[model samples]
Target: MTNPKSEPEMAGMETDQTITPVIMSGGAGTRLWPASQGDHPKQLLSLIGERTLIQDTALRLRGRATGFAFTDPLIVCNESQLVPIRTQLADIGQTAWFMTEPCPRNTAPCALMAALEIAGREPDALMLLAPADHYIRDEAAFHQAIGRAVPAARSGHIVTFGITPTAPETGYGYIEAAEPLDAHASRVAAFHEKPDFETARRYLASGNMFWNAGIFLCRPDVLIAEMQALREDIFKACQTTFAASPKTKDTRALDAALFAACPAQSIDYAVMEKTTKAAIVEADIGWSDIGSWRALRDLAAATDGNAVRGNVLALESKDNLIYTDGPLVAALGVDNLAIVVHEGQILVAAMDRVQDVKTIVEALKNKS
Candidate 1:
């Protein structure tokens, strides 16, 4: 193993300006089953590139090449993920602080807790809220998007990064960019929920819509204010949990009972949809949330039409996703399906039905 001591420190940022990266890492990742379990989620696994998804996410803002400066990340995740996340980041020589959630309360409360925590300390800090399981291929474009959003964010706009829709993707929500705030940013006209295939097609044809990338850049004050106004109950509950809980070393645990009582909602639903100050920066970066097996398969799509890993042998398979953990995955004349072999589980489902994989996890939970 190479010494992590040689890894670069957080550098290249101007002295006066700094961005605090608050990474939301609390995803169960059930759509990517067998390989992604409750204990070990997809963010910790190297599904695509050499690095784990969370590692890729962490370094997205920090780099000598991009010159994007960031403080050590404040990671919010379940307690079970701490050890693996710690070990993973250490391998890359990146140091981060962990905020452990007492229970899973979704992203709205997670974002609220982080915004409040950071606001308590640095009142004027700029925070870039990013998901831990996205894949962005273009680093330069991603950095440029952040650069464009910073000015808007500092001007008190809650700037959400929007991805230019490559296809009519029904899996993501859409943000209709109404008017240009500038050459790079736009004022959000309306936030559209996930559309059906027909609606998504119309959105793509309109040329005014962008995929809601779930990435945001805002000051702590701005975020907290929006949360308070839009979701007072969540704000109060998270505040109570924060006040009641204590920090030990680099970890802060939320009050489980208090937090569990908080309303479950996404940050988009709670704030961005209702906020008048919502702004958007168009990012052409190759981005995918990789929420399903089909998405992951598309990443490694080969000339032979197979996206495979480990000990996979496809005799005549085409347009199929075949994966193996510790066993052999053999496919013959299969097409448009996902086949996964784990230590004790074998998953085979149609590519179209891959999104329903979460039902399997739900069934297991009900049985227990």
Candidate 2:
């Protein structure tokens, strides 16, 4: 493991004009299912290239024109993932702060904890909330978009990055921008949850809706205020958790009972849906959450109508995604199918039906 000891410290970046990268790595990423297990989720796996998704997300903040605004990312993840998070950070020579969670209370509490932490440390700090597992092909455009959002974030509005919909994707929620705030920004008209195929198609045709990218930027105080006003219980939960400065001995393992006691809700539900301070920024940076095997297959480039990963071997497969680790995989006459073998577990499902693969995992768990 390479030590980032010599790297310049960014401890006080909030004062020196830097954006705090708050990464959320708590979820099990169940959509990817068997391939992304509870013990080792998708964020820890090298689902894309040589680097894990978490690694990619942490490094994406570097080399920006925001004047060292992106540094020492504060990673909010589950307790089980601390070692891997540290290993990946050390492996890539990136400095980070770990905000560990003992239990999963969904994203609202997770993000609220981060906000409270930052607010306590630096009330004026602008933090960017991002998911660890996402695919963004156009790095330049992504950086440009980040730069564009800083101004809005600084202006006291909760900014959300909305990816311009290329197709009718039923997997992601949609955000409707009411009017153009500028060339790069707009006012959020409303938030829409994931829709059916026909509704998604209509959204695509409207050209006013963008896929909710789960990326947000805002000042810590603003988020706290908005959250407190929107859902007082969530705000109070985060306050109680932070009031005692949740123990850092075990990588800041949050109080499990307290976290579970907090209501399970997403940030969108707890705050964004009710806040009038919401702003949307649309960009075509080639983004996807890579939530499912089918989504991963769509993101992966196809060669001869097949997308293969890890130790895979295909003979007559077409339009298939084969992802396995260590095990040698062989496919014959398979089309539009996903085959994933990981740690003695195999998942085989039609590409279109990959969304239902979680049922198999649930069944497997029942047997265990």
Candidate 3:
């Protein structure tokens, strides 16, 4: 509720810059269904490597880098996820602060609530807002990217990491980089919504566009001021909910009624698109949101063009992704498909249509 304690006081941070990593872990990940469910979302799963996605995210931001010291990660998620998230973090020998949402109000309200909490404690400290489910392979490059953005962020600019697009990705939004503010950072020219195939190709060919990585860095007070100016309704609702909530030494569960009253909007729509202080830092850190089965397949594909996990036998399959946790999957001459079996559910869809997997999840929900 109130400014509890600064990072130096709470976590014993010692550096010129103290960054509190806010790991946003609230998405249900319906697009990665069967394996990724509401109660146990993709962030809790070890989809990429040995550790869970959230665990990896926490570990990625841990320890001190060259120019900054990171406090323990602050995880934000639904109340139902608190126990599991705490357990997961503990498994990695990591301690974290948590804020539990009573209901989902998307990232805008989530960011505002986190900024309010952090600003109350440390107004000068920067908050690095990142999703728990992204897959970034290059930790060194990521750290470098953060270092490049810190000066701009400290100068009162809200910086978003822009991933160098390897392909024309229609699934993610694009950021048009305007003039170079520095060698590593750029002024944002415009924010474009997800484009069609032709438009995506154009974006790729332009050489001045990058995929919106959804990772952001800014001072908590700066973010609060921007939100207050742009979305006062959301700002007031989150402030009311945050103040009304009860807090422990490390956790706060938001008031359901108040949180539900807050409008649902992403940080992009609410603040970044309209803010004059917006900046973009180029990040070639092998970032992937792992948004769908196709994305996972692309990340893990073998030279033979198949991403096979568990007991899968593909005789002549090419460009097919098969994952199983229970039984063995045997595919014969299937191409460009995703075949996944987990728990008691199975999903078989063309890789081209993997983005439509949410529709199947909705259908199943209605059937239930």
lDDT top scorer:
3
Off by over 4 Å in 2: 1-16, 66-68, 247-251
Model 3 segments more than 4 A misplaced: 1-15
What digit string (tens of lDDT, one per residue) describes model 3 on residues 162-247? 99999988999999999977777888999999999999999999999999999999888778888889889988898899989999
- What's the distance in Å from true for residue 243, model 3? 0.7
The model with the greatest TM-score is 3
Worst 10 residues of 1 by lDDT: 1-10
Model 3, residue 82: distance off in Å is: 0.8
Model 1's TM-score against the true structure: 0.93
Per-residue lDDT of 1-368 in model 2, one digit per residue for the tens? 11111112323234445678889998788878777888689889898889999989888866446433565778998888888889988999988887877788888988888887777666656788999888788877887787777666766678999998988889899999997666677889999999999999999999889999999988787788788888999888877877755555324667767777888899998888889889988878999888888888877847767778878888877889898878899988879998888879788899999888888878888999
TM-score of each: 0.93, 0.92, 0.95
TM-score of 3: 0.95
Model 1 lDDT per residue over 1-368, tens place:
11111112212324445678888999989999988998789899999968999999888767433324677889999988999999999999889887998778888998988987777666556788999988999988888788878667767778999899989999999999978877777899999989999999999999889999899988877777778877888888888988987898788888788888989899988998899889999999999999999999988889987899899889877999988877777888889999998778989999999999999989988999
> Which residue pairs collide in model 2, if any?
18-69, 19-69
